[model samples]
Target: MRYEPISNELFIQNRKNFMAQMKPNSVAAFNSNDIYPIGADSTIPFQQDRNIYYLSGVDQEDSILVLFPDAPKPEHREILFLKETNPHIAVWEGEKIDEEKALQIAGIKTVYWLKDFHKIFHELMSQSETIYINTNEHYRAAHDTETREDRFNKWLKENYPAHQVAKSNPILQRLRSVKHQLELDTMQTACNITEKAFRRILKETKPNIWEFELEAEIMHEFLKNRSRGFAYTPIIASGKNATVLHYIENKHQCKDGDLILFDVGAEYANYASDMSRTIPVNGKFTDRQKQIYNAVNRVKKEATKMLVPGTLWAEYHVEVGKLMTSELLDLKLLDKADVQNEDPKWPAYKKYFMHGTSHHIGLDTHDYGLLHEPIKANQVFTVEPGIYLPEEHIGVRLEDDVVIQENGEPFNLMRNIPIEIEEIEDLMNQ
Candidate 1:
């Protein structure tokens, strides 16, 4: 890992929290993500499964975590199964985590090689009444590919027909949604790296520079700061491209009067930071551009204040929609009649501001928080609100990561990142 090691206490606490929610005599298991193949002998880079990483802090492939709190042996309560490392294998792929290192990384005393998994798992399963299997149940998930966890779940169900099964997703959804201070610290680091990249781009962007050039500059900054790269595919849209929310071609040349909508962030130690900023290509917003920019900025500010503790996610979006509607009416994008006659399901502001104002942001860009439940303090979210005007060839969005507080407004994680029109213009021209 390019990033520094995280404290094992975070994983230890996470495991404890997960175990607390498990049914008595239940043994829960988590598996690492597979190294997916592409075409020939080549394979995609390995990404550790978030659940396993959360519980064990083990970032390697072919790893498993078993939590059996009621085990006869105390050491067997929390066990880590890692792939055995040989000197020859170490020479090719660098040193894999040995048992001692695994113990240090995960704070689990018991460790075994993958070869002993079957015999050990059978013995453990026989002692437990229920099995908790980790599954992907995030709201945005729609993958067709079967993951390593999915394969393990299938095999377990088929092999042990008599064992009672339970889903681990619900428990994890509630637990992982609340941010630990350690997690917030790592995410803050990722946000700081993203801020540096944005500042770098502010100085580098100029009229006639191709969009890809800006992408390269951002990547350079991220790699220099110990980040793997973007948390998600970056959208470096310029001019009319900004109106298209997901535009990522990044092939067009930026014009003097055009604006570049940058939806990019850096990832540190697998934690994510999401930010979106629209800046003038030539370091100066026109009269009309400034008006729209300030409007979106205002919406983002007001929307952020709504992210207090005990607020329901569904209700929060409704309030944000009302805020956006008021801004749109002021901008003349929507009039009183437009809003009054609009459908409740799809409001008048939908024409200019289409997407949701905010989403949970952490380990994943769109991180885990149950949308139907009330949000809690310490939960981090992205406050992004935008207005896209295709006819005017203008789109403005200002986003920042924030943490909800027990009282008052949320704390802005990207508060240091320049967002004010004067601040951005001055820095870009300087």
Candidate 2:
């Protein structure tokens, strides 16, 4: 891992919290993500499953975490199964986590190799009455590949037809939504790296620069600052490309008067920070551009203030829609008649600002908070508001990560990143 080690207590606390929600006499299991294949001999980079990483802090392939808080034997309560390392494998893959290192990283005293998993898991399952299975229940999930966890779930259900099954997603959705101070610090580091990249682009952007060139500059800054590149694919959309919400081609040349909408962030220690900023290619916003920019900025500020504790996620978005509607009216993109005649379901603002104002941001860019629940303190969210005018070839979006406090407004994690028109212009022209 390029990032530094995270304290084992975070994983320990996470496991404890997760176990508390499990049914008595239940054994829960989590698997590391597969190192996917690209071709016959090539493979995509490995990423640890967030569920397993949250519980064990074991960021390796062929690993599993098993927890049975009320087990017949104390040693089986919390166990980690790691892929055993040999001398030849060590020489090839730089030392995979040895038994001792696994204990140190996960703080679990009991460790077994992958070879012993089937036998041990069978014994554990026989002693347990229920099994808690992890599933991808995030709102944006659309996986077609069968994961290691998915395969295990199928095998377990087929073999143990009498065992009661429970869902781990609900508990994890709530638990992972609230950020610990340590987790917040890690995410803040990611945001700081993203700020450096944005500042670098501010100075480097100019007329006729290729969009992919800006992407390279940002990646360079992220790597130099110890971040593992972008949290998501960098969106260096300039000109008409900005109108496309998920534009990531990044192969177009930036024209002199066009606006570049940069939607990118860096990841530190697997925590994500999401940001979006639109600026003119020449380092100055035209009069119309400044007007629209200020309008979008105002909506973001007001919407951020409403993200404090106790706000219901669904209701909060409805309020944000109203704010966006007013801003669009001020920008002259939506007329009064358009709003009155608009469908109650989509609303007039959906024409321009369609996506969303905010989403939970953390380990995943669109992380694991349940949208139906009330907001909580220590929860981190992103406040992103935009106005995409395809006809005018203008799209202005401003986003920042924030932490909700027990009292008063949420704390802006990306506050140091330039957003004000004057501040951005000064930094770009410097």
Candidate 3:
């Protein structure tokens, strides 16, 4: 990991909170993600499963975390099974965490080698009446590939058919939705890194520069700041390309007067920071562009204020759509008659601002928060509102990550990053 080590207290508290919610005499287990293969002798980088990392702070592959608050032996209550390391393996793949290091990192005293997992887990199963299996139940999850957690779940079901099975996903979704102070701090670091990249690219952006060049500049800043690059696949869309919401083929040379839309972020300590900013290729927005940008910025600001506790995610978007509808009417993109005759299912604003206003942002770019539930304090979200006009070749989206507050409005994590039209123009001109 390029980032600094997180305090073990965060993981300790997370485990305590999760265990408190588990059924009595139940054991929960989390597995580390596999190092997926790309081809022979090559593999994609290993990313620790967020659930295991959230609870145990174990960031390596071939690791498992087992939690049994009620156990026969006190030492077996919380256990970590890690791959055993030797000098030869160390020489080939760098040194892995040992027993002492694991204790320091995870605050767990009972650690075992992976080879002893089945033997010890079977013993625990014999004592426990229920097993809590972790599964990916994120709202956007649609993958077909089996993960390490999935395989572990399958094995546990086959071996312990009599044990009552319970899902850990619901508990995790609720728990992970709200941020710990440490998690908020780590996410701030990620946002700070993203801010550095945005500012650097602002100085480097000029007419005729390839869109990929700007993407490269952003990546350079992220790497220099100890971030592991973008939280998601970056969208460096320019002009007409920006109209395509998920545009990532940054192959176009930016033309003068065209607006480039950047939907990019940086990851620090595995926490994500999502941001979107649209700027002029020549460091100055035309009158039309300025109008569209300010409209989107206004919508973003108003939408952020609605992210306070007790706001439903779905209702908040509907309110934002109303705000955008008003903006579009003022901009002459949507007539009063157009909105009055619009379908309830697909609002008139759908023609321009199609996507949702916000989503939970954290470990994943689109993090885990239940949309049906009311928003809560410490929940981080991205407030993004855009107006895309393919006919005019203008697309403007302004986004910032924010933390919902219990008292007043949501706090913007990207507050330090320039978002106002005047500030952006001044920095780009300077």
Candidate 4:
């Protein structure tokens, strides 16, 4: 791992919180993600499963975290099973986490090799009456491939037919939604790194520079600051490309007056910070661009104020839609009658702003959280509002990661990052 070690207390508290919610004599299991295959004899980089990482702080593949809070033996309450690294795996894929290292990384002292898992798990299963299985149940999830967690769930159900099954996803969705102080600090570090990258680009970006070059600059800054590159695949969209949400083919050369949409962020210690800022290729935005940018920025600010506790995700977006609708009307993109005559299902603002105003941001960029539930204090969300105009070749989105507060405004993690038009202009010119 490129990032420094996180304090064990965070994982300890996470485990304690999770265990408190579990039924008596029930054990919850979390599995590391598979190092997926790419082509012949090649494999994609191993990304640890966020849930296991959340509870155990174990970042390696083929690892298992067993949380048996009510185990007969105290030592068996929390155990970690790592893929046994021998000379062969070491030679082929480099040294994986050993027992001593795993113990330090995770707070668990009971560690075993993967080879002993079936036997040991079977013995443990004999004592456990219930099994808590985790599945990817994120609101936006569209997973097709079976994961390691899925396989284990199948194995457990088939082997222990009489055992009562429970869903771990629900518990995690609620728990992980709210941020711990440590988690918030980690995300702050990520946002700080992203701020550095953005500042660097503000001073460096000029006409004729390739969009990919800006992407490279952001990645360079992230890595130098102990971040493991982008939290998600960056979208360095410039010119008309910005109109296409999720545009990642950063091959176009930024023209003189074109705006570059940088949807980039950094990850530190497995925590994610999501940010989006649109800046001119040169030092200043055109009058039209400035108008649209300020409009979107206004919408973002207005939308963010509603992220306080007790706000429902559905209702929050509807309120944000009204904010966006007003902005579009101000931009002359929508007439008063256009909004009045629009379908209730798809508002007039949908033409300009399509995606949701916000989503939970944490270990995963689009982190797990129940949208149906009211927003809670300490929950982190990204407030992004954009206006895309394919006809005018303009798209402006301003986003920041914020923590919901009990009273007053939510705390903006990217508060240090320049957002004000004048601040951005000064930074660009300086």
Better of 2 and 4 by lDDT: 2
Give the local distance difference test score of model 1. 0.93
Writing each residue's lDDT as its tens digit, candidate 2 over 1-430 gives: 8888899889889999999989989999999998999999899988889999988889899998999999889999999988988899988898888768877888898999989999999999999999999899999999899999999899989998899999999999999999989899999999999999999999999999999999999999999989888999989999889989999999999998889999999988889999999999999999988988998999999999999888998899999999988988887889999999999899999999889888999899999999888899999999999988898889889999999999998999998999999988898888
Worst 10 residues of 1 by lDDT: 356-365
Query: What tens-digit string does per-residue lDDT give for candidate 4 at 183-294?
Result: 9989999999999999999988999999999999989999999988888899998899999998988999999988989999998888898999999888798899999999
RMSD of each: 0.8, 0.9, 0.8, 1.4
RMSD (Cα, Å) of model 3:
0.8
What lDDT score belongs to each candidate, Candidate 1 first? Answer: 0.93, 0.92, 0.93, 0.91
Give the TM-score (vs. native) of candidate 4: 0.97
Once model 3 is optimally superposed onto the true structure by TM-score, how far is the C-alpha of residue 332 displaced, in angstroms? 0.9
The superposed Cα distance between candidate 1 and the true structure at residue 280, in angstroms, equals: 0.4
Query: What tens digits encode model 3's per-residue C-alpha lDDT throughout 1-430?
Result: 7799999999999999999999999999999999999998899988889999999888899999999999999999999999999999999989898889998999999999999999999999999999999999898999999988888899999999999999999998999999999999999999999999999999999989999999999999999999989898999998899999999889999999899999999998889999999999999988999899989988888888888888888888889999999999999999999999999999999999999989998888889878899999999999999999999999888889999998998898999999988999999999
Q: Higher-lDDT candidate among 2 and 3?
A: 3
- Lowest lDDT 10-residue stretch of candidate 3: 361-370
Off by over 4 Å in 3: none
Question: lDDT, candidate 4, residue 144?
Answer: 89
Clashing pairs in 2: none
Model 2 off-target regions past 4 Å? none
